[model samples]
Target chain A: MNDKVRNSLFYVGGTAVGFVSGFFGGGGGMLCVPLLQFGGLDAKRAHASALLVILPICIISAAIYIKNGYFDVTAVLCACIGVVLGGIVGATALDKLNGTAVSIIFALLMIAIGIKSVIA
Target chain B: MTPQHVIIIVSALGGVIGGMGMGGGTLLIPLLTLAAGLEQHLAQAINLIAFVPMSVVALVIHKNNGYVSIAKSAPIVGCAAIGAVCGSFLARYAGGYELRASFGAFLIALGLIQMYKAISAVVKKKKASKNKSAQIKVG
Candidate 1:
């Protein structure tokens, strides 16, 4: 794509991604990954770059949630600590696992909970 | 195990996935609601908040690993911010029940797509290996 076309695409796609991320309070990166790939990044770079987009959007969304009277210091702290440690581990082991297997498992769990979420 | 412990464990699991480049919030939000009994909005907020620090750290790792491309990402930020503001406000008004149901629908769609991709990838890999073995036998 030409620079102008790509830029416009990014702008429009970004808006949709942000809306999904913000409204759902998560899942923006999934949209972002493909969007980045469209912008010419490889899969790994697209995933990483998606994080760049998600990070700031999440910050903004989180702030709005706080301002709207949703604040839980204890939950945030516990989750942060766990996430950081787990992030380090996962990042360290990124190249070792069978990615397909992991994703399949994740998808199954997501589908199961998704059904329950809709029902309950 | 207490709720806090469950929160930590699930967060860690989510983080590990997030660190691997998938969005962890997809898993974390539902897990929080189910395991910790948090309301959907609150759980979403927690996922958003918890994501920040971990994202920062993961970004650094990705950048160091040469997996970050700023040029492709920068153009999207401004529009995304505007979209984020609009979406957040909408969520604040929509209440948790409606949002939760919609989120479930979204998850179902995404999970189905991802599962298809992963399964296809596995099948392709197996085919490739089978082709290689056949070539070896022929030679």
Candidate 2:
């Protein structure tokens, strides 16, 4: 696709992704990765770019949540600490690994989580 | 486990998933709601807040590994930020039940798509290998 068309699509798709991420409090990456890949990025770049795309959206949504008194400082702090550590490990692993297996496992997990969320 | 322990463990798991390019919020919100006994909205909130830092960490690492494309991602970031603000307000207005149901549905749909993509990729790889072997035999 032409650069103009691709840029427009990304902007539009990004809006949708942001909306979903904000509305649901998460899951933007699921959409963002595929959208980026569709726009011509490789899987690894798509994933990484998805993370960058999500950062701003998360901040915006979290701000809204905080304004509504939904903030949990303690939980957020603890989670941040753990996530930082895990992020290091996972990202490091991503460099050396073939993502196909991991992608499959992740997809299956998402399916299970989706079912459980709806039913339970 | 203690509440503190649970928090740490869940966050770590979320970080790992996020680092892998799957949004951790999907896993984190459910875990907090069902396992930690947090109110649904509150759990979601926590997930969003935690995601900020986690994503930053993951992004940095990905960048270091030469996986990020700034020119490609900038426009999406701008638009997504606007959408996120709107979505957050919408979630607040929609109430918990509606929000949860929508999230559930979204997850199910995405999960199915991912599965199809993975399967197709596997099949394609197998066929390509088979073709290569056949060509070698003919030669």
Candidate 3:
């Protein structure tokens, strides 16, 4: 594909991914990684790039949420503490772990959660 | 466990998942709403907020591992930021019930796809190993 075409595609696809992340408040990376891969990135690169893409998107969206008074301060603070720690551990493990196995399990977890959310 | 404890544990788990590049919000939102009894929108908002720090950490790690490409990521980030703003507004306007239902449906579809990918990968790995062993025996 031409540079113009690839650039346009990335922009359009990024917009879609960002919208999902903002609207749903999660799952943006799932879509973003695949989109990056389609745009010619390797899996690992896609995953890493997706994180970069999502960081700004999430920050922007979260700011909007906070401005709109849609968040819980206490919950967010506690969750942040835990998520930061987990992030360190997870990032460290990425190089050493079997990502496929972890992914499979995560996928299963997603299915279970999705079903429960729909029914409840 | 205390609510605080629950929040910490779940958030940590979500962080780990996010660090893995699977999007922590997939797991975080549900845990918050279902287990912690948070409102749907609130849970979603919290997930987004938590994502900021988590993604930064993960990105830094990936960068060190030589997995990130800034040139490629720039366009996507710029466009995604625009889309995120629009989506945030839309979510704010949409009703909670509708939002929850749609999110659930999205999760189901994504989950099934993930499962298929994982299973195929396992099968392929097994087959490759088997072929390697057969070659060794013949030699």
Worst 10 residues of 2 chain A by lDDT: A86-95
TM-score of 1: 0.92
Which candidate's TM-score is highest?
Answer: 1
lDDT-based ranking, best first?
Answer: 1, 3, 2
Which residue runs of candidate 3 sit more than 4 Å off their true CA positions? A1-7, A92-97, B137-139
> Please, what is the TM-score per model?
0.92, 0.88, 0.90
The candidates' DockQ values read 0.75, 0.69, 0.75
Q: How far is candidate 2 from the true structure (C-alpha RMSD, Å)?
A: 2.4
Ranking by TM-score: 1, 3, 2
Grade the docking of candidate 2.
Answer: medium
lDDT per residue for candidate 2 within A26-98, as digits (tens), equals 8888888889898779977998888888888888888898898886777778777877887777767877877
Clashes in candidate 3: how many? Answer: 0
lDDT of 1: 0.86
Off by over 4 Å in 2: A1-8, A92-98, B64-66
Model 3 C-alpha lDDT per residue in residues A2-93, reported as the tens digit of each score = 88887778789999999999998878888888888988899889888888888888889989988989977799898889888887777678
After superposing candidate 1 on the true structure, give the runs of residues whose Cα lies further than 4 Å from its correct spot: A1-7
